[model samples]
Target: MTSAYWPLADLRIRSGPLELRPPVPAEYEVLADAAAREPHAHPRIPFLEHTADTPLRRGRRTLQWLWSDQGTWRPDQWSLTLAVFDQGQLVGVQNVRAAEFARTREVRTGVWVFQDRRGQGIGAHSRRALLHLIFDGLGARRAQYRAAASNQASLALARSLGYAEDLAPLTADDTVRHFSLTADCWRTRTDPVSTHVTGLAPALFMFGIGHE
Candidate 1:
């Protein structure tokens, strides 16, 4: 479906200099170009071997999973895939998922920034935006995040956002750290600063996560 008819046309979240919005079908080329330009810096899973350099053939396979039927549209599952924009340019992608969402009321989040965009607090801003939409807009009870032990930045971001670290297996190169944050914890923290989002509730639920 065209983005206009895809249901999340107006869905957006802004945090200071960042703006998170659903990708329009017209944006597929933009995303593809971005993916092709810098194919080494964007890692989808911290512990997985899915790097930007994983061949367009392999990349296409991954994209299919994210954009196809087996992807984000199941009734009990939802995914919000956001195009992270900084000053009007698509710099990265952020994904939030909820399985059995309507019943579980919980979501998990993951994000990646372009190589040149790293270390600028954009990751933090993008994450906070999703958290706001989940906790404030969707009434989610909790949000979970996992970071590879080697990814100090992600681990740090999770901690900064008040996610309590959970005990998990720590291995040589596959260490995974799980963290979670609740609505009450988020409310007690300072609200994220944004300028693009207003009435995010209706748009949030209708969009069903992955498209936006």
Candidate 2:
């Protein structure tokens, strides 16, 4: 079980008060609990199952996407979905994903924090830590944010991180507001928080980082 293919299981990203790592089997149940407690932000996203439904189904739905994403991954086009933990509590999940990333030098991320976990700076630095993994760890030239126009929380977080506006389109009536951050711009930001990574070298190679 030890090979270059193992970054999905081993990568870790950490900030002052947050940590990101792929969850094990036991942790998935904890993620389910976090999901049961969360008030999902946008229920319109086709792929997401609504958490406000039945209690029994809530936990089932919460674990489905992660397991499915794991099953569908490929190095050329895949999402590194990490469980977000604060101190020791599972609070949310974060994803850094791409297609033909070695050639494109571009990546996009998705994040979610539970209802109770909102309002702290977790959302900001969590994404920041992912950006660092993209730009600094994986040699990305830029990263994109396609936020729901109706999701003021996501839009505000993107703005606070110094992302610039870009044009994008989401599903019908679900307006997609776009934003982007370049490697250079990422460097100049006043360092609201910094990130450190471990077990990322293998992940970088899986991403075709140095091969390009």
Question: In terms of lDDT, which candidate is strongest?
Answer: 2
Error of 1 at 200 (Å): 3.8
Off by over 4 Å in 1: 1-5, 37-48, 51-53, 69-72, 168-174, 195-201, 204-212
Best prediction by TM-score = 2
lDDT of each: 0.71, 0.77
Candidate 1 lDDT by residue in tens digits, 115-146? 68889988888888888878877788899888
Residue 35 Cα positional deviation in candidate 1, in Å, after optimal superposition: 3.2
lDDT of 2 by residue, 1-212 (tens): 23454655778888988889888878888777766655553543322445447655666776786787777777688877788889978888888888999899899878878778889878887888888888888888889877778788889999998899765445454467878899999988766667899887655656766531
